[model samples]
Target: MFKKPTTVNRMSQPEDFKNAFVVGTANVQSDGKLKWKIVAIFPNAGSLRQHGNILVVAGPGGGKGRIITVNLISWGHSAIVIDLKGETYTKTANARYKVDNGKGKVVVLDSKNGTGHRYNPLSVVSRDQWFDLAAELISVTNGDPFWSSVANDLWLAAWSAAQHARRPHMPYAVELMKLDLSDAICYFMYYHKDDPATMQHLLDFLGTRPNEEQMAKIKGGNASRLLESMWKTVKTTMTIFNDTILLNLMSGHDVDVEGMFYNGGITTIYVIVDETKPRVFAAFGRLIMKTLGDALIREGDKQNVVRRPILMLFDEFGRVRLNDVFDWLDTLRSRDIVLCIFLQKLSQFAPKNGKEFDESDENSFHHWILFAPNNPSGRIGKLISGMSGQTTVRADGGVGRSVNMDGDITTSRNVSFARRAVVEQEDYETWGADQAYVTLRQLRTEKYVVTSANTDNLGWALPPEAQPLPRLSSYVSPLMPLPSEIDAATWTAAQQIVEEAGGDDAVSNAMRAALGGLGMAVTV
Candidate 1:
């Protein structure tokens, strides 16, 4: 055998040199891939940067709650989750401490009906916020003249009550009363009845009180009966009045709790209702969300500083009326409020009466999370595919014949060919051509992935039982040790040395030397 060239013993190999090579100035590669090496890879840092929000979408039994809980522990952030389905999150490890936070404060708003949880708009929000929320609710009813009238009357009555009670924001009440009937009529007329003519007539009637002849003509019109019925319903419902006691009860507090809004604390007020009987639940949930959004916007303007971030976590978001949510999402982020909506499917957001879907609305959320879908070909699938940036591939071919000649005599032989080989010909031949071959296969199975930054850390690796417990909450406590304690201690020691010097120049110099010897510092 040829003798191998004499090799010198060396401290390192060529691979090691390859690992250390730099691609650009100041861009050294310590790992196999340059980009990965530069990227910060903290194994368990849970906090995400503040530029964007996150969304976590998973199917039932997909471990969404476990993921959220774990991330909350890791990130040292607060959350307001609207827990539907009565699934208590207590089973997760160290859940009690996470809930309590050692401040003798843990707020859980149970929105379930019969649990005595009901939200009243007047309590949690200011007068202007309440007005905006009411506007949204009325808008949802599509500006039904009857609904408009009812809203107008109720709002006017609420204002009077507030004024009578000497509430601070009484001007908002007077303003409601001052809102021209024409404007209210137009708003309700367009949305609820879906008729421009009806709106025009209502506006005209408001401007110049219609005579019996004009009224008779309006009554004979195509939408007259609908308008009549709408008015009756509105008038009846608007008669209901709100007093201080009702307002107190709706906010889940006595007068003292209302002051908490002005104070700084996480206040979770639930508007619980029975999901099985959806009518009441839907109405209440919509009202509450609208009210909260309005309040945050108003407060941001008044305070001039975005000091806190309000998190509105809507579980079972599909059941609530979502008209104003798109608008809220577009604007709320700048106001330091984030809305986290959890929905089962995209189909649940579809328009009810053959209306066009407007995905391009500015208020629409920039992020979405898709979970394992039950129906891969339905609207939900299409919505997911649209949001996910997926693509399609197609292949076409057919079987053919081949011949071979051997020896002196030419012989005709038949061989098979595939239109689209299930396996590449080379791969099939590697396994031996004698074995049966398959061709033209397509894969279609729904899976899950994190789709948004706000929800990037949610969901399960396997099922809940198989997932490793999240270990974030054990690291620090807001109510206990401050994260800057060590730095503070170092500063304190330096201050003590300065104080000990007692303005003596010689002693100060000697003290500096002593501190330097002890690996410390004394600043003059």
Candidate 2:
């Protein structure tokens, strides 16, 4: 808990606060009335525009959850909070769902705890986006371009086939990838050769029979080339989709962002993720970020009836990569999707040893809220000192005796003033825990306020932990990766043929037959 200093906090006056997003609330007094803490921000000047985006810089166990989040929920802003510990959802979901007297909806993607709404990440993705989907799931190395392209091609093929097979989820896609490349090629070439809806370019890429249009011969050469490229993708996907709880969480299409928030009554969506596995969890995190924007845009095209602007409260912002953050910072604002990025420290922005972040990354947000105090000489403190800008301070002058070159004595006095920083660097270094610096970039002035130390005196009621959400019983449970994609009938036929071939296991007649006809074979 942060202790406030005895003296009142002095800051620049707040001005140009049009469309002001609430930052903090007043500390509880003996009267116990919750009042908005509207500290002065650029009270001397005005600005034309101020974006709603906020960047909250704070450390763990601070009052970010209690001061900022609790109030925002109480203020009834639509949010997509990344509740790492499920604490935010547990405390706020009841009030959020019961808003407007039971019309509000709360969507929880609580895979880590294994109790929440289930969703199929693939169902929301259209067929044309399969190539993009492949890009997200697989991390191609910088070492080779040809191999990456090959992997993407293989992924696209398997992705399409999995969707065609009615199980387009990651678990199913991973299962499809584990199969022999030629078997999948065979399914596309022979099994769906006559089907008009399949990808013909892919078909032509992997050649057809001799009498037809001569396409690239993929049976031996292409399949072998593509087979090894899948090692990285298969390993990564397998590791992520291997969790039973994650599979169950993504079992169906229970997360309807379009119906719920875009067109329906649901305003807040809380995704409880495994904070330990940021990279793995980022896949799903990225999915939610992209899907929500897509849903809003898609629905806006039809009716364009939007009453409230949407806010995405990303609690563990530093857990996600800055590369992804930069992309998000560029895209979501225009669609009325504002982001409230809660971070622990400045270094946390560049999680991967500073490779992913640079000086430009800090400018992405419209406003900055600092909860962590810093050393006066440190980079962050210096930056805050600069942000506080300079103010005029008057100095009174007294009469003094002066002698001119002509030997005449005269008395002269003058009053002078100089501009000094509103809040000095040393102040930041020695500030108590309760103090936070609010920088309104548009207003061009730094502000300060003392946040409440705990959640005890919050104006709004916290949703009780016993609040229950409606959950479906049947979810996509985990299953072992299938040994191979060959069916029972094909396996039986292959065994009989190979048994007829004296049981040779080295690419035996049984194996090729079990491959379900890579080349021409006798119809039993």
Worst 10 residues of 1 by lDDT: 34-43
160-233 in candidate 1: lDDT tens per residue? 34433344222233232333332333223223233333333333322222234334444454332333433444
Please report how far candidate 2 places residue 271 from its true position, in Å. 0.4
RMSD to the hidden true structure, all candidates: 27.6, 12.8
Q: Which candidate should be chosen as best, given TM-score against the real structure?
A: 2
Clashes of each: 17, 4
Off by over 4 Å in 1: 1-51, 67-75, 88-101, 111-119, 138-147, 166-232, 235-248, 251-263, 266-271, 302-306, 350-363, 374-376, 384-524
lDDT for model 1, please: 0.36
lDDT, candidate 2, at 132: 68
Determine the backbone clash count of candidate 1: 17
